[model samples]
Target: MEDYYVHPTSIVDAGASIGRGTKIWHFCHIQSGAKIGDGCSFGQNINVANNVVIGNGVKVQNNVSLYEGVELEDYVFCGPSMVFTNDLTPRARYPKGHMGYKKTLVRHDATIGANATVVCGHTLGEFCTIAAGAVVTKDVLPHALMAGVPARQIGWVCKCGQVLDKNLHCPDCGTQYLFVDEKAGICKCGGGE
Candidate 1:
């Protein structure tokens, strides 16, 4: 028996692997060789390209296109209109895959804010926050708050996506999270082993 949910307007190709309890909403297209995990949700007008890996419990909002070489770890949040690019250079005459492509990794529990642009070859650390409209060209550290053009670290964020309070604690849930020195770049929180 099938376990996932695909909307009537959505098209999931034959080679795509969609796990149990996932919900793909309106006008979505899941291309061949894509692998989507359980309990994930893709909002309207979404496109998941071939060879993409979408982890369990991820939430992708509307107008998102997860192109090839984009891997989203479990519990990741992709906000509305976010864009992930695989190929750095583009020409109408010169096709991609001919020049090769680099991958972008969004680690577990990371939150990518609305309209963000994730340039290829960067690793977004676990529980990291990429602020709205940020263009990420470099790797982000865990629990870091990134904003502005090209995305520089402005502050720190908790795993719950809450801005850390004065004591580096989550004011909303009282869950203590990690904070690394801006210079040292070391990070650990409640789940640190």
Candidate 2:
């Protein structure tokens, strides 16, 4: 038997690599050249496009599409119906293939909320949280709590997925953080304990 589990209704194309202990649920399609790491779980109606790299322990909710040129690091969470756009400017008449696709990177331990739309060619730093229904049009710093259209940083977040207080401390985990710059911060509690 294969290491991973693909549901009877799901389609895993030849040449797609699904790591050990991964589970692909019903109606999911994993295209050729897609690399899904170990211990990942993909919900129903999900599409993983060619050349996409998804790291270990990633959780992709239902109706999500991971397009080409999108890379999700380990422990990333993609909420239900979250959208990823690979083309900066898409047109039906003019088709830009791989060359025209822009890369979108979501770093480790990030959470992309439900219905969030992430425009390509930007990087979401580690431990960042994109709020539900947000439109992310730019790079998001590490540990940032992003929300609203165009996804502005409303505040910082702890690695435990809790919003940090003004003192840069997490109420839930009691983790401490220090400002690195205007757009970024570092977890003082041993790398976001």
Candidate 3:
């Protein structure tokens, strides 16, 4: 595609779908059946497995691997060395193939920091931030900031990647957010002001 940039050292399979203005850097491998949207960037040594879905304006840093059954919404950021797994119980010699795939969703504008591990079957809410080296095993709420082992929410964040103040407002972007508790035991945000 004329709008995309793929380094000569990168290997993109024949069946892979790359969108407009996407940039794939050195040593990256995008497998067949992977769908990458417009204005995305995949840094060095990144690997995107088949059946993976990456949305528009996503920024994936170096050394990341997005496994099968993972879907990233628009404007998502995946930091360096971040890993995503579709299998809950991965064995060294298991051969279930794609039948064992478990879906993982990263919502719009979310940021997953460097060296983080995201287990499958969980949805990261919109505008959420997962700090570096965190292991995410459960669903993250909207605008939440999660860190540490097992990924606990230490505070709330805004879509602009700023931690929210006491008034639920982001000073960096002057964006306001609302937290609502639903019957599903999840907190939802109404987006920026």
| lDDT of candidate 2 over 50-166, digit per residue (tens) | 999999999999999999999999999999999999998899999988999999999999999999999999999999999999999999999999999988989998888999899
Local lDDT at 107 for model 2 = 100
Mark the regions of model 3 whose C-alpha exceeds 4 Å error after superposition: 182-193
What are the clashing pairs of model 1? none
- Per-residue lDDT of candidate 1, residues 12-131 (tens digit): 999999999999999999999999999999999999999999999999999999989899999999999999988888767988672477889999999999999999988998888999
Candidate 2 is scored at a TM of 0.97
TM-score of every candidate: 0.91, 0.97, 0.91
- Cα error of candidate 1 at position 2, Å: 1.2
Which sections of candidate 2 miss by over 4 Å? 189-193
The local lDDT score (0 to 100) that residue 184 gets in candidate 1 is 41
Best by TM-score: 2
The best candidate in terms of lDDT: 2
Model 3 lDDT per residue over 43-127, tens place: 8999999989999999999999998999999999999899998988878787668898899999999999999999999999998
lDDT of each: 0.88, 0.94, 0.89
Candidate 3 shows a clash count of 1
